[model samples]
Target: MKRFYIYLLAFLLPVCCLAQETVIIKRKLTNAVKERVSVLKSDNVTKQGLYQALWDSKTVLANGSYTKNVKTGIWNFYDTKNNVIQRFNYTTNTLLYEAPEDSATNCRYVVDHTVRDTDRTTKPIVIGGRFFGYINYLRLFRLPPDMRNINNEVVVPTIELLVSPGGRLAEYIVHFQAENYDRKVGFNIDYLSDEDKTFIPATINGEPIACRIFIRCFLTSGGDLDLF
Candidate 1:
C-alpha cells in the first residue's frame, strides 16, 4: 500500500505542473489588404493565427512602445502588419485651427479631399493623397449675399510629396486641383499672410504622403469675402 501511494503521488505531481504551465496559442495571417465595404466583417482568429499576430505587432522603432494609445490628434493609421492604412486628424470636439498662410487676411476658400493610387505594388494600392481624410473652408471675411465671389467656382492647386531623410520633402509635385465654389474671379485678388489652409497628409494607394494646398478664393479689395 505504501509503494502504490508513492507512485500515484509522483505521477500526479508532473501532471499538475504541466497543467499549470502557460499554453501560448497562435494564429495565422490572411489577407492584408484593406477593402472598403459597407459593413466590415469580424476577424476570426486561430491559435496559430494569434501567434503570427503577436509576432507582427512588434514595433520597428526600438525606443517606442509597441502598445499604441487610443491615438487622438494627427495619426497615421497602419495595419497589424504595419502597412499604413490611412491618415487622420482626429479631435474630441469640433476644434478649429488656423488655415495655414504666410500672412493674415480674410478670404473665401473651399476645402477638397484628394486620394491617390500608387503603382509601386503588384497591384495598385490606393493610398490617400493629402486632403483625403477631411476638408473644411472658412470665410475669414464674410461675403455679402449679393456679391459675386470667385471662390464660388475656383480650382485650387495642390502638391503631394514624401518626406526625405534630410527632413525635407522629396520628389514633391502638385497632385490635383480642388473643386471650388460655383463662382468666378473678376479680378486678380491679392492675398494676405495667414490666408492659406493646408490639409493634413493622407495615404494615397496605401503609402503615406504629404501635400501643399493653395486655397482658391475671392477677396474684395476692401477685404470682403466674395463668392465668384
Candidate 2:
C-alpha cells in the first residue's frame, strides 16, 4: 500500500509541475479587418500555443487546446461580446464535434432525481456547463428591470422555462404582478440564470435533453426579495 501511494505521487508530480505553463505572443495578422492577437497559453512540451484573437478586450475571440503540439480538446470561437459563436471538439487533431453560434449554449436544463441506465446506449453526459451548475445559475437570478420598476410596490412573477436537449434555453413565460406581491412562493426547479429568464439543460446518454421548470418570485414592498 505504501509503495502504491509512492508511485501515484511520482506520476502526479510531473503533471503538477506542468500546470504552471507560460503564455506566448506574436503579432500582425489583422486580416482585412482589425483583428489582432490578444491572449495565448502555450504548452512547453511542443513549444506551441493557443491564440485568442480579440478585437475587444473583454471577450475571448477563439480558444482551443493542443495535445502533443496538435490542437485538441474543445475550441471555442466567440464574437465581439465574447459569446461563443462556434465550438468544435478535436481529438488527436481530428474534429469530433462542432456547433454553430445559434445552437450553442442556448438551451436550459433541469435536475433529475432518477438514475437511468442503458445496455447498448449510455446516457448523455452534460458537458460544457454541468447539470448541477444550475443551482448557482439560479442564485444569480434577479427581477427584471421592468418588473422591478414598480414604484417600490410589491411584485410577484411566476416564470416557467423550458430546457432544450442541447443544454440551452428554449423559451420562458413570466406573469408579472402589480402591487400586491405578498403571495405564497415555492421553487421546485433546479436552477435559474440571467434573471429568471433562462435555465440549464439536462442530457440523456451524454446529450442535451429537454425539461420544464417553474420559478416563483415574491418581490415585497418591504425592500427585500423573498423566495423559497
Candidate 3:
C-alpha cells in the first residue's frame, strides 16, 4: 500500500506542474495603451485565464478572467487613476458595482446634462464606465486646425449623447465653443462604433428611461483633449 501511494503522488505532481504553467502575452493597442494576458494554452489554443488591458503599461483599465476565451466571473473596469469605475459579473449578466455620481471626479468627465427638473435615481452609465468613454473620445475626437493655435485659454467642448431606453446611443451632438467661435456638430447613431453605442440607460424608479449624457472636455495648450 505504501509503494502504491508513492507512485500515485509522483503521477499527480507532473500534472499539477503542467496546469500551473501560465504564459503571459503583451499586446500594444496604441502608443500608450497595451494589454497583458496570462493564459494557459489548451489543445484548442483558446485563452483560458486572466486578462488585463492597461494604459501606460501601469494603470489597469480592465481586468477579468476568461474561460475558453469567453469572459467569466466578475470583471473590473477602472479609470485612469486606477479607481474601479465598474464591476460587472459576466456569468450572471449583472452589474456588481458602479461608482456613484461624484461631481468632483467621474462626473467631471461625463455628466447627466439632461434639462429635466426632476431628479433621477440613477444616471446613465457608459457600457464600461466613464473612463471607457473618455478614452474613446480621446481616440476618436480630432482637433480642428483652426483651433490649434489657441494658447493660455481653456476651451470647453460639450459632447451630448442621447441614450435610448434600450441602452443604445441614439444621437450625438458636439457643441464646440471657444473665443468668438461656436459650432455645433450632429452625428447619426450609425457613426459611432459598435462598442460606443452601448450604455446603461438612466432610471427614475427602477424603470429604464431614455436620457441625455454629456461628455465635457477641454483642450490643452498642446491641442490635446483633457478632462475638465
Give me the candidate number with maximum lDDT.
3
lDDT string, candidate 1, 56-110, tens digits: 2352101111112222344343333344444434334222332232243211221
Candidate 1, residue 71: how far the Cα is off, in Å: 18
Off by over 4 Å in 3: 1-32, 37-48, 67-69, 106-120, 143-153, 187-195, 219-228
Segments in model 2 whose C-alpha atoms lie over 4 Å from true places: 1-21, 31-50, 92-228
In order of listing, the candidates' clash counts read: 37, 22, 0
Question: What lDDT, from 0 to 1, does candidate 2 have?
Answer: 0.45
lDDT (tens digit, per residue) of candidate 2 on 23-131: 5554322221122322324433353445454443434555665544555677666554556544556463333333432434333335453545651222222222221
Question: Can you give the lDDT of residue 39 in candidate 3?
Answer: 68
lDDT string for model 3 (1-228, tens) is 999999999999999886745677887644566778776644435677888888878888898998867778998998888988899887997888998766665242233444356654677777566765445655555666775675526556777777787888887776777788777766555656776787777776677778877777666565655553
Cα displacement (angstroms), candidate 1, residue 160, comes to 13
Residues forming the 10-long window of minimal summed lDDT in candidate 1: 60-69
